[model samples]
Target: MVTITVTRKSQSFVAPSELTPSEMLELSAIDRVPGLRHTVRSLHVFRHKDAADRVASRPAEVIRAALSRALVDYRPFAGRFVGSVVAGETCVECTNDGAWFVEAVADCSLDDMNGLDYPLMVSEEELLPAPEEGVDPTSIPVMMQVTEFACGGFVVGLIAVHTLADGLGAAQFINAISELARGMDKPTVTPVWARGLIPNPPKLPLGPPPSFQSFGFGHFAMDVTSDRIAHVKAEYFQATGQYCSAFDVAIAKVWQARTRAVRYNPEVEVHVCFFANTRHLLTQVLPKDGGFYGNCFYPVTVTATAGDLAVAGLLDVIRMIRDGKARLPLEFAKWTSGDVKVDPYELTFEHNVLFVSDWTRLGFLEADYGWGAPSHIIPFTYADYMAVAVLGAPPVPKKGTRIMTQCVEEKHLMDFKDEMKALF
Candidate 1:
């Protein structure tokens, strides 16, 4: 086993290089959802490269300077989340508080950790930054750590509160930092903070905020190769006479296989919830140029009985997922207009709910900070819920998607693996 040691060199706050607005910024209803109150964490791994100059070899200094510039436009990220007088609402107090930054050094190279691939060998605590024991995580909207390895390679770990942005929006913020690090004056696509454009929900009764709870799930990484996905897509098209996306087939297979492996009671209700991007759906309100950096995706859930999922054909499962995604526009409208009473953030694990997040199109790999694009991008840790992360595999000749899942218990883990293997 390879043991990697990381030492912290410095810790400080990175405020915006230029002065930003000092006012309260009201977050959209989607941003203030109770479920998204937690922090989102990720790690970006970059390989060692020969540099022309000494200053260019240091990634920490370059990123620190670039992050300061990036915060000028994304000022909301530097602010803290404050509760609103209105029930079930939170807003960002843009006090220019600044983001937390850490510089660290790792004693090993990427190769020592298997190219920083799936089944991450290093501890998340070593790579990601965290708040002190008494500090509230939400008070720091963003925290970043850059850990350079002995071989000159580095890893960038980030933690951002979900209320500030979703996967795409967060990627936009990081990309801006990358642009500035690469000597660009500004980001390619300017960010827009049109939070009010998303209609607010009518005043609703406030409830106790949700807390994180772990179910002791055995986490596993399942790689679905491109060839396997292609074969499944072909089979689906032949059976349904309709085309389906890679995500549709992949998620359907996992949901079906998991339901069967868990052996839930026939009458037990099972649900698979995934977020659908509303950028195109809300083009009238959001910019089409991809500048709206906020939480614009909403959850769409497909529910069925365990017995039905176990017996249903793959094509049928895919159709159910398709139908669920198709309802995003209407469901989002109802949610915004106060017609739907269901709180999207009030999630239940109960071993029956699967929350799948697709990060394949989030543009995390494009964050090239002078060295080059990162070779791999992965979440720092899985959520306590039965979470499934669909991420793009590391850059390789044979491309594939890595599905990191934490749903099955230890006893049923082998059965779940077998079921997934038999599908391909």
Candidate 2:
């Protein structure tokens, strides 16, 4: 494992022309040219365990470096780097607020934030919700904010534009930085755009997309909240009584039940897309240490039905998701991993309602920024029926484990709660 040291690198400012091809690619990645709201999607929040103690970690320094590099090209476009203008993007500076952020840097990691107090869990309504105001054409690609916390650990807030990549992609970058912070000579993976290898967006036929007004101008979107996380982690078992991962079994049973209900789509084919971390996939194979720049993880897209997800066994669901990952290099993986490799006008398709697997997919949840691990990590709440995930909480003496989830609507959410109680 190779990691870069933040302390060793000069906090130097370099023009884009001065950068290597790879560096330039990274710089360009942040440009908020219109149509790439993902370039500004706000996903992922980071927590430091011991506040001040983890500040010196090389990973933290590297993150700062990356930010500086991004600014070289995507510097504040008239006050902000880039974002949905209709929604009003701004680097809203703040000493403190309830916004959920990726990084929360503060001058002092206060002592009062010890345990539950600092990692405050409020109602879901109070958490960061997706922008309701027309995806704010000017929504800042990066919303930088810092504040003092009761705990010694300072929080750094970074909200990436969601159109570019999802939460899974953001997590990969963070983990890579952690590797560097630990002083690894080489990073785990190198990012590759590989755009040339894929097809253009809308590869064939298509239709007119909904106008901005059709999306309710992004105002009707609900806000995400911080309801305390709760879940149960268990291993999968076969009929022979052999044990498997709880995630595998849970996914299997849920989707399996759904598969039995709906007739599988023959033309488009219904499947589950599991987003896996690809940082280690290619990087681990390298002999030298280096930074992997482009987004690496390949989305796992397994075909199934709504009924399949609702009634499949844990092991089966895990198997389906894992299998999709195993075949990333396949043509199918490229078409549906959320990359607009094919133009939407041609396919008339978008990832229709993502059923995300949150709890067991990502490793390093125990990422200790020196203070200690986080008490919890919740899923994005801005997306309606489409974006859903089951989050896991840290172990508490009495609670053991817990899970978080999003539903299609209020009724489905309540139904799920009922199902969970009956099953558990």
Candidate 3:
């Protein structure tokens, strides 16, 4: 194994290039969700083969300049989240503070680190930026680090508060930076900060936040070849005469394999939770040009007994997932009207729940800073047990799907692998 060491050369705040508005931006209920108050991190790796002259010579300077320009429009990211006057809620105070930026250098080349692929060779803390010890993360809306490798390759690490944007929204912000880095005068899509456009329920007192307990979870990644996915879809269609997407079939397979590998009691109830984008559902409120970049995705869950999921046919699981997805529009409506409330932090941590997110279509891999698109994009770390992310695999001859997970215990890791292999 190659030992990787990243040292920070400089750290500073990159403010907007132009003076921007200073106002408090009220967050939508979805944005103020207690569960999303934390920060999410990811890493985008670029190889030296496609590096352009300017970016290859001074990656940090180019990105920092681009970031300053990008913040002029996406100014909320340059602000901090503060407690709202309405108790139990938070809002973004657009003070035009700036985003925390770090310039770093790595001791090893991208090749030595396996092109910064799955099972990352270095610690996430070393690559990603974070608030200083004892400091609140909410104080900083965005944090980024650019680590240059000896091979002229580089890695861009980002830490953004979930309250600011969901996966797609964050991608839009990154794409804006890339556009500027490539010398575009302006972003293709204009940013919209109409947070009040999304109606919020009346403020009501709520119970204390739920306390969570840690589990002995281990992170794992598995490659499910494109051929295997196609084969399963074909088999399902032939048997049931129905169509299923790659996400539908892939997640169903993981849900089933994980349930079996955990060896849960036959009667125990288990849940598969995933967020569904609701931008289309809010067409009346959101812009038509697809510029409303905020937290627009809502969580949807499918529940069944452990035994049922373990023994259920792949087709049955796929149908269950599809059915759950079909409920997003209605569920989102209820959520908007305050008819229902979901406190994700209140979810049980007994390993009976699986949180799945699909990143293949989020466009993170499409972010280019003059050097070409990233070779690989991966979450810095899974938030908790049974947190599964379905991501696009690095460019390769086959180029399949990569399932990154922190689902099973160390003892059951081998069993989980065996179960996943049995399916393929």
Best by lDDT: 1
lDDT of 3 by residue, 106-187 (tens): 9989889878776668887888876567967667888999999998889899998888898899999999999999899999
The candidate, 2 or 3, that scores higher on TM-score is 3
Clashes within 3 Å, all models in order: 0, 114, 0
- The C-alpha local distance difference test score for the whole of candidate 1 amounts to 0.83
The TM-score that candidate 1 achieves is: 0.94
Cα lDDT tens digits, model 1, 195-236, are: 888777775665555445676778777777888888888988
Q: What is the C-alpha lDDT of each candidate?
A: 0.83, 0.37, 0.82
Sort by TM-score, best first. 1, 3, 2
Over the stretch 60-156, how does candidate 2's per-residue lDDT look in tens digits?
A: 3444444434332222211223224323231222111111223323322323323323134322222233333464433443343222243333333
Candidate 3 stretches with Cα past 4 Å from truth are 1-3, 51-56, 84-86, 203-208, 341-350, 385-389, 395-398
Superposed Cα RMSD, model 2: 10.8
Q: What is the lDDT of residue 8 in candidate 1?
A: 89
Say which prediction, candidate 1 or candidate 2, comes out ahead on lDDT.
Answer: 1
Q: Candidate 2 versus the native: TM-score?
A: 0.53
